[model samples]
Target: MAGEEGKIDPMHQFEIQPIFDGGFEIAGQTINFTNSALWMILTFITLWIFMLGGMKREIIPGRWQVMVESMSNFVTNMLTSNVGEAGRKYVPYVFSLFMFILFANILGMLPIGVIGLHPFTVTSHIAITGILAVLSFSIVLIVGFWKHGLHFFSLFVPHGTPLPMVPFIAVIEFISFMIRPFSLGLRLFVAMTAGHVLLKVLGGFVINSTNAGAGYGALVGIPSFMLMVGISALELLVAVIQAYVFALLTSLYINDAENLH
Candidate 1:
């Protein structure tokens, strides 16, 4: 929570403050390193280290290798179940996407504020999530057209329908298909941001109530702190579920492209 003079600002965590005073300017656009970029880089580094450690290939696997293998199998099963044989080639892409989002979400929820470090959730921003959604959607489009050429347009039309209704149905289907990226990105962004905002608000309640007196501490602060604990657990669940949902939906969309259903 960010505030001055005892005021609370729940949305302050989402702000992307620059680490440097000024950065390189190119083509009339200024690009500077910010907290968001730092967190993203950290996410990548952490993931790399974890993966590297897990790839030691011991004759008898350790817990670290077990975890890596389990997650890899999970992603592989998700893709194969949804996209079938052709999806094997896309495993690398989908697994990377899932792990990146999962780690980013988990890193944001770490209680590092006690250590004077701020944890930034990259997925909480629509801009970041939107890019991810677009990248997945782009793969779908590219695969569809590359494999089927003009026949890919048939995706907007169902298998069998009345000739006259085909035009109207196709138009509606096209609009819905186009909305996937926005909805996909918005879902993850909203879920992550809303949970953080709620937690921040509850944190404010706990602080203010405890500061008031013994009565307020018992009545408000205690309850608020308990609720925050529960919500934090729920937020962790949401992080994992969101990552799975994202990967699952990407596979399903890829299925449509690969099989043209």
Candidate 2:
């Protein structure tokens, strides 16, 4: 049991478990809800509770109210800057995306794994991120075509390119546009997965060190613990940054589609 207790499986943390086994089915397909769904719902609810609870008419805002306002303004500024005046209409969707991702990333960093809890991060799964990316990309596509019609295709073709290079450049642009969803999703998935794995490795070392008794364990364990502390801080920064980057990139994509430059 000691040997088993010392064992660590980093990838095991990403596994998805159904919340209800005997879930409903549709057309012979088992439609079971999962931890990912649960967490996503929780993230949304958390965002709503914070925002709703914080909103009140006051001369001086409280901490939660200030945070809510700050977060709203931050995302609003990002969209307005990147996507311009037209982006105001999209503030709702973009803000929700930002909040969901930010919360999910933070949730992933919780040390529930050490306590034998079935912790999970939905953003760690490519399926979740991929769907989000695709949805964002689809919105861009639909809006672009709706506003610009066939001229939206001009997005792939450069304005001042020579005839000979036009085809090649257009092909390259097409490929890059097509890869947006893939890249966006993969970026989030990889960041969450890799960060957790590294944290788990260091965490496991900490636990294993304690099991090894004293003596040399202290020499190795102290440094690992310190490094883990640093890593945890860095991970928190990364979680916030990744969410910002995702939203920023998405805003830029929207700009590209809208103006077709």
Candidate 3:
């Protein structure tokens, strides 16, 4: 293993591994704790730390307290501005999603190595992000119908349409609505997975070139190493942007459902 030709398998980093030696099976499905679950728990712990620290009213707040207050205020403002009075009720859920995703994205970028013991980014996986999207959309649907009743159907029908084209327009709207969760989840997954893969590929080039020793390989390797560093910095920005985009889009969707536009 030490003398392997190359170790550039980027997707290998996202593989799931069991924490325990054995897992229980029920109804042909295995229920076992995994690295993903561990990362999720870690995310929750990070969130708890900030929230708990923020709860302490201090004349001068610490960094963690400031972060907690700043993010809480940010999400609160986003919700109220986007979704209005009704958005206040959903602050907890929105805040939780934002912090959890923000923590997951930032932590995943840490140099934890390709080991099971290290933390991973759960948002990079489609299954996790898709589930979140579905849950949010489910709330949108339930709230839409609960608030508007039979008139909820109005969401499918445009403001003004010719009589004969109503069915076609309505069908198009329904299809667009159905595609939201998939698009939302896939957007996040693709952004994260692609960024990590690029970083790994560039890193591999640096590693392979440097391993080849002091001549031509080193010439190519040094620039590649520099490029890798640059990309890592870029990835950090992408991570924050992706997390914010997810939360912002979720708020916008809530607004669309509540206001029917």
Candidate 4:
């Protein structure tokens, strides 16, 4: 009976109205700040503090150092297991990507309204994810070519494939490689956007039903609240998983380019 529209708009929960408007005279470019920018800035600052604070070389590990080390080790192991020892060189970029996404995801969970600001999520923006995906893809492309030269193209051709199927296989491989950026970006964007929308819709239903003095509203509201809590926890996990997956896949692609296997 609730959420009967079967479609919920999560954008309503966050205020995305533009705060500044400026047009560049030389380049003919327009720039404006929005709630999304505020959240992104917050995410960046949070990441900087957490990471920079723990960057000191300590003989005995502090809590912050241990936290940083754990995350680094996690990415290191993931890379080594998937891409071997040669992949260690990519740990810095991979770790940076993971920390950025992790911070964005966690910050979005906070109630920004408490600080008198709009609650906008970085992951909800396709453009943001697209940019990150492009960066990752670019790194993979550059590193692949740098490490293997023209041999990187050989990744499209499988060694065991028959000659007749080579052209078709190569085309498919190329297309799939090209699609990686869009696929990776869209997956994170859609998942975060959809989860937030679901929570907002459920919260709205509970509030409206309660105002109407509907006796059943309490039952529905309680469960809806619980569902929201569960989703928040799940989103935290999804955030880390998405980042790890992105880094892991990038390493794998690099490995393919290097070994041509």
- Top candidate by TM-score: 1
Per-residue CA lDDT of model 4 for 1-261, tens digit only, reads: 132454435567554656677523446644557768778898889988988867896989899999988888998997788788977887888888878877887788676555775567787778888998888888778877988898888888888899999999999999999999899788878877877777677767667656657676776777877887887788778767776776777777667755568
RMSD of each: 1.2, 2.2, 2.3, 3.6
Residue-level lDDT of model 3, residues 100-189, one tens digit each, is 888899888988674634557889999999999999899888988888887888888888788899999999999999899998899889
> How do the residues 76-162 of candidate 1 rate in per-residue lDDT, one tens digit apiece?
998888889898988999999999999999999999988988889999999999999999999999999999999999999998878
Compute the lDDT for candidate 4: 0.77
Clashing pairs in 1: none
lDDT of 4 at 48: 88
What C-alpha lDDT does candidate 3 achieve relative to the native structure? Answer: 0.85
| lDDT preference between candidates 1 and 4, better one | 1
| Candidate 1 whole-model C-alpha lDDT, 0 to 1 | 0.93
Angstrom error at residue 147, model 1: 0.7
Candidate 2, overall lDDT?
0.85
- Candidate 1 off by > 4 Å: none
lDDT of the candidates, in the order given = 0.93, 0.85, 0.85, 0.77
Model 2 pairs whose backbones collide: none
**lDDT, candidate 1, residue 54?**
82
Residue 195 lDDT (model 2) = 86
